[model samples]
Target chain A: MISRTFRRRVWLVLCALALGLAPFPVSAQQSVYIPITGAKKLRLALPDFKIGSADPAANSLAQTFDGVLWNDLYQSGLVEMVSKSFYPLQQPGTPTDLGGGALAAWSAAPTTAQRLVFGNVVVGNGALQVEGYLYDLTQPNKPFVLGKRYTDQPTPAAARVIAHEFADAIIAALGGGPGIAESKIVFISDRTGHKEVWMMDYDGANQQQLTHLDAICYSPRLSPDGSKVAFMELSSAGSRIRVLDLLTHRYARFPRLGGTNATPAWSPDGSKLAFSSSRTGDMEIYTINANGTGLRRLTYSPGVDIAPVWNPKTGAQIAFESDRTGLPQIYVMDADGTNQQRLTMSGYAVSPSWSPNGEALAFSWRRTGGGEGNGGAYDIYIWYLANRNYLQLTHNGERNDFPSWAPDGRHLVFAVGENESWQLFTILADGTSPAKLTTAGSNTMPNWSWH
Target chain B: MSHSRLRYLCTVMGAFAVMIALAGCRHKPAPAPPTPPPAPAPAPTITLNADPTSIQAGQSSTLTWSSQNATKVELNGASVDLNGSQSVSPTESTDYEAVAYGANGQTASASAHVTVTQPPPPPAPAPAPQPSIQDLWNQNIKDAYFDFDKSNIRPDAQEALQADAEFLKQHPDVDFIIEGHCDERGSAEYNMGLGDRRANAVKDYLVQLGVDGSRIRTISYGKEKPFCTEHTEACWQKNRVGHLVLATPAQ
Candidate 1:
């Protein structure tokens, strides 16, 4: 017979597991759970079309197709494309199997290929159609197919969209999710006269300006409700917290005391707002009714307090950045302004965002150098509130800031340096390779929408 | 003139009459040399000064005037009785004038501007010390931490609860509410429960410290409220804790 203690331990484990597996509302789900067990690795083959055929336009079309395909595959992060220079064809009929696979009917012609890629490009009536197939050297019987027909009658720009669609299709065929080629990323871009919020597809397409105010607006946070955006707007006098209704296109300022206010965070219920204010002569956390009444001061320290976030599990407490210890560190305090506690002991940390489960907080900690772009680099880190363990999520020497965790807590969206341009990037929670999600102007202050 | 003793006594009498007349004319001329007109006396000069020039409202000030042979003094357009000097206290600024009456009842006067400025009262000292939980909360307690989805006391939470325990032990009548809160990431319902757990945790810890558990009530605001609404983790961490509030006195 099992001991009573053993039975109790087993029961506790089961209960924890059940809590972890609780089902969320169907409408609240934004991500599809893809099982990795059925995922398979496949190869592709593309037919070689002459660089400049007798039909000059057809050859040009083939060259453009090759370039597009190469770039798409390189960015897909799913397959490794073998270099063409490794295999040389001495003659047209030379059997060139680079990976030692049996060459089929085309073995006579310089058919040196590992995983073969065969395609045909036809130009007809001002339209270009490219069809291709990818074959695995290990399994010659099955080949992955890919094709796209582009109509250039309207304009050459239309062809780019077609090419992107083909790339997405290839990604899906390879058992990867659809490439973010069509998805858009909304971020604050200062390319305009002022720092206005803008949106562009992940591939830098369809750039559109969202805010047109003369005042400086920064730290745009998308509402979990998906209907509004809350951001800090700065004027000559002080900062104003405002929310822009996406559907109505109307903006409302948060009623605040007499001082500069920044970092407006909406509670999970959307009934209250948490922000930092200097009304009492120093930066401190404050909460007010969402309609902007019933203001209550939450922190009363001589040190600078800022960057407040609410816990998802309990809205009664707030996490903020404070310099009470002579260094910027993370601190947790009661919602009513009592029971203040310091959470992080070292490093200059800011931008603390709670995960959906409230078990972890993701913040940017300055590395030894300094903050990125300021002669120092920073990385996104998650602090497990329960265990007091910190996990660094980025290794790049660039400045990464404003990390927002996805609803599932498996992925995080942050800003990373790309070619001297800061853009939005997403990475796994464990600090894996980052995928660029925005290609427009420098994008910062990314807040992921909640499911 | 006895007809100058009528003529005669003609010659001799006439001579006597002339002598008499001459004597009378001499005496008369001297007497009647019309009492010459008396010289005009000079005007008396009056100067005024007030002791305690600046006096508080409803206080009196002494108005002193110096006059050379002046008999009367007036203050603020009103007559003031004075022997040598006069005491006049006006609610507002005023001018004082003094006049002296000569023996013939003729008056010579001099005037001075006597301004009575009101003085300000002294500042009151600060109130004496009172028992306050604000001071205790601010000075003694550092901060409180909560477990994931829990408001209850974890080992880490004891450090802050201990401070509360000490504060209560020192003041037996003190009562407080443990307000629980959650971060902005979860649903409102989940956050409410989490906040409840946090408040209960602190209350339990206070109870363990020999404090009256009944004196401590728990209120879970849930994710409906937050201290910092920013998307940053710093804000979320701040939103997750148990707040201590002084209980309102019974009506």
Candidate 2:
């Protein structure tokens, strides 16, 4: 038996050598192994950025970048930015600024920070330059995880852009998919006498009016590719779901589904659009090719069916709002409208926005009383598909409605009414960290950009 | 000449006797007793009238009345100023009575009938197109309302629809666009569909009331165009309604 086994092993090794192939397989996965650390968010130490000189402009630029970077990372829903007060007495603004024996011990367990982020910002000769870095304190052997350099005009807006870019790099390292740092939120603003499509940075900066159609244009939905926006514009011809390409600044061709067409939603692949149309004398869910052809009806229910949202990941199911059961509630159906199931039981629910993972839904809901007493007290709520349970994301007051999820799937942007005007607001998916986003005029119907 | 002289002599004798009688009367032939006091005034007379005495449905008529010596006056059991007038719009033939009470504890009433005639349907209006929805909504056309998240017609809104239906039938040329609205509560997407339900609910009622179904166009504004800005129940109730827009010929 020994002689036979030895002969077989020799033959196999000889064959491998003859074929110039390796004798073993390597198992390698490139993903970083980030410990969940239970329910606590990853703690990050953000220190003040260093300025090349004591010049007032340079110092101001440095300060602006630091604040913007901190706010950007803090809102990512993955990190809890540690305050500078909790940092070590010997604070390091840059790798070279570290005191003796600090860089090696950069793993500041005393501050409960597992990671650290800091950079240097310099404004000289009418130009701004910045360098950002991220350090994984646990790995002293190779602590640097990211390094980025950005150069732009020495303006406050440029400083904010630099910070946003750096924050996105850090988010990518943390495995939160592509960061929404450069994303724009296309929404409806009534600042110019008539409601029109407007866009703003993910951080609510650079709010620009995209459509000048001084008519009623609203319900803006950014296509998955972030290049086109489809919305309903009211005209003498009735409400039409029209498409506006941001890059081209022109209305793209759209299928003409007569009657009243409104509340459009883009499919995950951007090949088709789902909307509610009353062309048949009753409002029903319909899908049409993105190029204004191949129209087909999806829901034939007697009650109204509208506001269709597709599951981003799977694309096999859609969630929409319907009153087929005598009250408005959230309903899920197969892509073809078969196997429809109701997801809400109690209060009137609408705007069933599917979570990126297809496991949850966020919708605007309000409890109904004697037809006249809903109080305009609607709030955003999340329904978990797995547990068949629901959670309220907003409390009373302000009448929060129209919750649209950021591409990251961890945050939501919604419209809130206060002082008789509706403005944009965002909150974490877990109902934490609620903050206002718009202030000047009534901003509403927010649809977060795909990127 | 002789006859005239004899006549003149007799007349003179008579005048002398009359002068003696006049002096006797001046002596006051026993002052006549004071005439008996006039009898008590007749019961207060209340004349209640309806101007023109007839009107078509949805048309106004003036109810004018005057009374004499009435301590209190009433119309349809509601106390009103005596000899006052008011405008009444009775949808059907109605008899209005005005009653008054006299100081002598006597009551008097006069009844007037405001005759309602169909008026032969106004020659059918040539079956022409009606006004635009903007005009109708501004002209005080009726709107239907729904419960929160509910598209079903509420019981209270049924009467409003019945009246709306009758109006639609009477003015067949007045094509409608039922604009559905919601309170500033639900998501705009779903609320829009809910609005569709409301508008369709009104359309169904109109069709059942004999108006052609195609004559009604429906659109849902969701909660966008709130008629009231307040967040109170009253404002929300007003916002949650189906505005009846008379369709333009082009629409």
Candidate 3:
């Protein structure tokens, strides 16, 4: 009912409001880990890798590489990829292909990916060649954030490794730091008719046996530099804490404390080892030099005190499991044994692995008031050091335990179980995606390599 | 009646009665010439002797003992069965004495000195060939089983340990190691500690039974190895045990 002039005025006012509410200038930001205030995922694209060879083997490997790459990026919980349906009409297969308006077209319309990662693969002569390129389209002009290549035998195992390595590189480039792709997970496996130490890639590929002791070896803990592993080995004489030097491929003698010596944890500096020893007439926390000389007793409780993990950040404190209160719970104290404090009040909690940043602890927690027979009764929980509160990463009735924090602090490796067999699984700190890392040999006691 | 005649009659009667009393007192002709104290009981021959009354150092011999006409006997201040034999091992030449008591409160003794001669010097024990801990484990010691996640000695485990203690007592020169184990049901680090407790519990019990504390050491395997691979309770029970290993320098 208004006149033409008044209608035009209302329309102009509406237009001004819309223009004023526009988003921030995305072109100025160069980082992919943006908006650090909330639980937001980065918008990215992972197009199929381009094949460079005419070999039919190359064609099949490309498909596999692409599938693994997509899954790896998705499971990272940091990148939210645009659906393949919404990809740009023209897909660039390399960093050089970002020119000629392909980048402009990919950033427009239904394709609103702010970052792009593309690569090429070649398979011939029993070898596979893979190259990956990452770019931040927010800059619009800069094309190369990183370019990495991998060469290995043309097999499914090598293909998985290549995919995981590329994913790690891309994630490292985007997260403003490093990722866990190049890391290894050490665990106990019974595949050889005896419990032995075994290792696999971060993505659970190329599982190779490490220890041939043909005896029971569990609680595989890697040194801070990943040069050695300390584990519990069973012998007729008793359980002896043994160290295997990965660099020299030799077994090293652990100090014989006479009384039950088990659960060895290396200090942050790699010079001292903290473990639970009953040499003092009871289960007490003890520290010994790595070469096995100085024996210093820490905890004096009549009950058990074990599973000591050093805080990688300050190296001043250690998180451990203790039953001084009748139920095993997580406790923190100075590395020199002072200021002892309980981190968990109730429920049975053990196997505490401190976060790399010293900001949180991850462990298996269960409400110990009974009624836990059904499943999902035990779960992985992270206790934030600042607020003293916790977040449950797994729920329901499935038992999840032995959570070892990745060096990145954003992921954790834990043991997931059903009935008797247990397997290793990795998930983000936010509990978004869970990827299984092992399947053979009833594996458990997974320890992630330190960065 | 004259006084002299009455006195003569009284004297005659008194003389006859006195003679009768004298006859009663002297009935058996001077007690058969004083009977020589029944031949003095023959002085109780003890004959405390050892069969093969000599031994090489570190060897054993049987001590055979007997006594005659004795109510009680003792050897080296310890009561031994009369006329019995016992095996005795002496580290050095030692003298054994047997004292027997007669019925007359008198004692007699005999001594059998077993000569323990030194043999040729043996090889160095540390470097000498001996069974390894693993080998001794299979043949020498018994294993103590535990309840799930528990280190305290259970009833079944105690029965096995009693025999172990007895074996230890019998073999003083041999030491042992107690290995605590678990059944892959708990955290590895925690189980390591728990296994340690189990082994130590056995060691502690052995120590209580007069076994030298230093003779028994303990270690925890923490569910690292399983003797049985099945997932049944029986398999788990096999895993939760304190295995014994004889301690030798070679081991």
Clashing pairs in 2: A371-B147, B133-B246
Ranking by TM-score: 2, 3, 1
For model 2, residues A296-367, the per-residue Cα lDDT tens digits are 899989978888889887888888887777667788999898999987665677767787767778888774
Model 2: docking quality category: incorrect
lDDT per residue (tens digit) for residues B89-148 in model 2? 998999999999999999999999998987575465477678754665566456777766
Error of 1 at A252 (Å): 4.3
Clashes by residue pair, model 3: A216-B224, A216-B225, A239-B220, A375-A397, A376-A396, A376-A397, A376-A398, A377-A397
lDDT of each: 0.61, 0.78, 0.77
lDDT tens string, model 3, A244-295? 9998899886677756566788888998888877767678888888887898
The model with the greater TM-score, 1 or 3, is 3
**Backbone collision tally, model 2:** 2
TM per candidate: 0.43, 0.70, 0.66
TM-score of model 2's chain A, to 2 decimals?
0.86
